[model samples]
Target chain A: MLTQRQVRLAWLLVLPTLLVVVLVAGYPLAQVFYWSLFRADIAFVEPPEFLGFKNYLYLLQDPDFRQALWNTVKFTVFSVSLETLLGLAIALVIHSNFKGRGLVRTAILIPWAIPTVVSAKMWQWMLHDVYGVINILGVKLGILSQKVAFLARPELVLPAIIAVDVWKTTPFMALLLLAGLQLIPEELYEAASIDGATRWQQFWTITLPLLTPALVVALIFRTLDALRVFDVIFVMSGVNPATRTLAVYNRQTLIDFQDLGYGSAISVAILVLIFLFVVAYMRTLGREALR
Target chain B: MRTWLRLGNRLLFYLLVVFVVVYSVFPFYWAVISSFKPSDALFASDPNFLPLPFTLDHYKNVFLQANFGRNLLNSVVVAGGATLLSLVLGVLAAYALGRLPFPPRNAVLYLVLAMTMFPQISVLGGLFMLLRQAGLFNTHMGLILSYLLFTLPFTVWVLVGYFKGLPRELEEAAYVDGATPLQTLVRIMLPLTGPGLVTTGLLAFIAAWNEYLFALTFTVGDKVKTVPPAIASFGGATPFEIPWGSIMAASVVVTVPLVVLVLIFQQRIVAGLTAGAVKG
Candidate 1:
């Protein structure tokens, strides 16, 4: 049933995209795998020496690598979970019929729209231990006896970074959930109310089950973004290892230390980790979400 | 009892609305106000939340002292160039994938999705080498070329949804008229998908404008560096001395234009964003 001309036209149009993708992504990714096997440093004069899986072997034993991995997972899990709960609350509230609803919806986009670096910089100033408004307000309200160095403290830095990520991303999650909320028919709610169901019962019985598809998609999307978080933490955390996620750590290895082979190995590890995440997500959520 | 319960629910609803608005809007508000505060007032003991004793020195300093004008120009060129390139390539690809009933359509789409999710850090070494070899390292075009990795996926995916939503009759009519595929796309479909193009273009521009990782790695000199890196590199006279007010001014200046544009095209942008995930 297919015409040869149509197929040819399709390939012609799609070929450019494939070419660009392969040049920028696919081939570079292959190059990364190749580079991962050699001990190459940008600073060195000699050609790279092949080490096979030695870089990966050292990576397994490297505590810094493990810490960065832990930091990435912690940030992703905590931030995404917080964003989900807060995003759900926001979606429910914004979905309600109210005056100024449109303004509230647009206002929430401010955080999401601003560049990540700008948001991080804004918080960097606000989290200042001495002159910060957060501490000023806290001291005024008697919540703290003195100012706490938010970014400098090892224990608090990751949480502080997570707070920034949550602040920036919750709006995005809310919008997706809001779209899902709109898809639920009003007649179902009306019928439930007419059947003597309480508000809580209606929500538990009607809203959540219907919203699962949207929720799953939103979770996966946010998880994918969070797993590669860089800008907010990089701009805010200064030189703290406590806040160094996988992307930030990888940048350090590739650009700062100039250890090309080790850095490429880390890159390979990250891809494998992300690939596993996508596979697990598919297995659990089923392919219906993709469609 | 029922009246009290109803009153409680009403109060809770209003409270939640207030919390949401305040939580989301307060940071930008703080940034705007802080940008105008004098250095003395910025670090005052009882800091003035209002823009009292306002000063334009921060804005003046951001441009005069920081060489930020050059960075702004660089951002405009890079983001603008990337947006235009992505739109061109994206429209062609979107036309094929969305309408043409091509073999391997599903595979190509998934390939695009995977690329969209491809970690930039993974490709940092490879891209660095490629850019250097092309003699484009530390140049605007390099950033634009690398940006294709993110912007292309977004424009194609969103425009695919837009193209698919169009009626098949239009294309068929063009075919009946003996129009070439390019002619039909240019003469018939392009006019109809104007809003899609604008929405996708604006989103891509904002993305490239805001990108930090590629921009940071690809460019070094202020002659080539974009706003994000320029702003990140800001420091005071001494290591301990931080220019909080100047950084805020840069943030507000960079953000206000985007916020205004987003406000104007909110609906289209929202539709474009959800069209991908919901349809997928």
Candidate 2:
């Protein structure tokens, strides 16, 4: 339906964006791939050496990489699951036609608007070992006798980070689900009620099916973000190997250890893993164009 | 039986709303209060909800001693620059995809989304090297470019949806009246999609302002360091203990603008942002 002139103008319009992407994203990505084949220096002054697949081989054997990969998986599963559940609950509450629902909706988004660093910092204070509100309440309530280092211990670090993720992002999930909830006609529920449907029955037959699409979209977005979890853990636990995810590990490899080739391989690996997940997710939801 | 059940459901709904409201708002309220509390009150054996011996010392220190004002100005400039850059680029790209019969439109969008999922760490290695070679390593321009990795993709995706949803007849009418393509786009399309642009622009601004990874990785000295990194530095555990009051004060400085903005545009922001995913 478009004329040749319109088409030309369209291409002209997109040129600047395409150029920026090529220069910034495209160039760097190509450079990383190129660097992956070279002997990237750990020390600044070493001359570059050709190392084909050697860097990737070394990375595959690295214990830290394996551990970080595991931690990322664990964090994604726990954080996304909790966020979806809590988000659905919160959304249902806000979606209902109740007094002050608007106020509640506004209130929930405050946490989401606050930067990740600020949220993590606040929680760090709350989770501090000695005088934190969490420990204080814990001891008073007989949850723990003595102070416990939440981020200091490796096993506890992932859970703590996941908890923050859940708290911060559940509101986002709620917002998305609430929007979806608005789309479902009230007449369907009214008809169900007229049919003498029980609350559980209405939920199972009406709400669940109608809400599935929103849930899937929320899941994909959350999973994608969780897989790239960095800022929260990074700000809370700086350079702590025990708590580092793949992102933190990749950062350490490049910035801390100055190993460009190994870091790029890790980055590429994470990209492939996330892309696979996204493809599967989109196909399952029948929304592949969402890519 | 139905009446009893209706009554019970009503009670449960109210209960849930109350609980959610309290849970959501309490931490923010506590943060504001804690910011005002005296340093002694933070450590007192008995803590109250209110800052009894109130003081402005923490705020004063945040402004004067911590150089929070400088960081705030830097955040504004960086966030403003990123917003403007992404808006201009995003609007153009979105217009192309929405109106023009471009081959591989869907593929390009998918690629953009995939790029968004590209983790910040992956690009840091090569980007650091590239920036160093180009002599932009510690510059604001370097930080801004890194943030575009996030802001640009989102702007294009969101704005494309917004532009597509708008009626094309408006632009067509303008063209018929002798407005050129650029003029029609500016005079006709831009004004119509004002809300969409602002909504997406605000989201981009917040992301840039809040960015932590590149800001920390690229810039070291306070000359270009941002609020997030500044906040982190205040709490670094040295031989001396972390300063909780100062940290809280700094958080207040960082979060206050975001809080005010959200409060003002709560409706448009919530609706505009969620519209992209849900409506799409």
Tens-place lDDT per residue, model 1, A1-291, is 336788899999999888989888887888889999999995556689999999999999999999999999999999999999999999999898989999999989899899999999988888888988888899899998989999888999899889988999999899999999999999999999999999899999999988988999899889989998899989988546888888899989998889899999999999999889988997878477555
Candidate 1 lDDT over residue span B1-280, tens digit each: 9999989989988988999999998888999999999999998988887999989999999999988999999999999999999999999999999889699999999888887777788898889888888898998888899999899988898898889989999999998898888888999998999999999999899999999999888887798899998888789999989899999999999999999999999998788777766654
Task: Name model 2 segments beyond 4 Å from true.
Answer: A42-44, A141-147, A287-291, B1-11, B235-238
Q: Tens digits of per-residue lDDT for model 2 on A1-291?
A: 346777788888888888877767888888788888887764457787888888779878999888888888888899999999899999988887778877898889888888999998888877877766677778878998877888778778778878888888999999998888887899999999999998789989988888888788778778988898889988888757777888888888888888777777887877778879977887877463343
Q: Note the DockQ of each predicted structure.
A: 0.80, 0.69
Error of 1 at B255 (Å): 0.3
Q: What is the TM-score of chain A alone in each candidate?
A: 0.96, 0.94
How accurate is chain B of model 1, given as a TM-score from 0 to 1?
0.97
Interface Cα RMSD of candidate 2? 1.6
